[model samples]
Target: MALDIEQVRHVANLARLALSDEEIAVYQEQLSEILEYASSLAELDTEAIPPTAQVIALPGVTRDD
Candidate 1:
């Protein structure tokens, strides 16, 4: 789905952002691209992948005996 300028304006207002005309235009394009990329990620198949809470592997910390 494409993001409209009005939507961007609404989001900026909700975020308490005071954007200039140029800044609003730039954010509108950047935010639209980000949303489009995120949408593409939904097509991936992850049935065999296990869910993880963290990206790095580490042993549990414990006090020394």
Candidate 2:
């Protein structure tokens, strides 16, 4: 699940980013770790479980401009 530097660079390029070598290297590791952690969620079994529910409701507040 490790993301390579090339892939990160490609994504940055698609977003029109101008990343330096240091930044690219940093993202390569950070993004890889994130993907690895997220992939662990695939092992969860939610078939018989109820969907996630909201614990609290927040009343909407709006300011009239």
Model 1 TM-score? 0.79
TM-scores across all candidates? Answer: 0.79, 0.72
Candidate 1 weakest ten by summed lDDT: 1-10
Backbone clashes in model 2, listed as residue pairs: none
| Tens digit of per-residue lDDT, candidate 1, span 1-65 | 57888999999999999998898899989999999999999989999999999999889798778
Model 1 accuracy (lDDT, Cα):
0.91
lDDT of the candidates, in the order given: 0.91, 0.90
For model 2, how does the per-residue alpha-carbon lDDT over 23-64 read when each residue is reduced to its tens digit?
Answer: 999999999999888889987887998665566766767877
* Model 1 Cα RMSD, 1 decimal: 1.8
Candidate 2 RMSD computed on C-alpha atoms after optimal superposition onto the true structure:
4.3
List ranges where model 2 is wrong by over 4 Å: 52-65
What C-alpha lDDT, on a 0 to 100 scale, does residue 2 get in candidate 1?
72
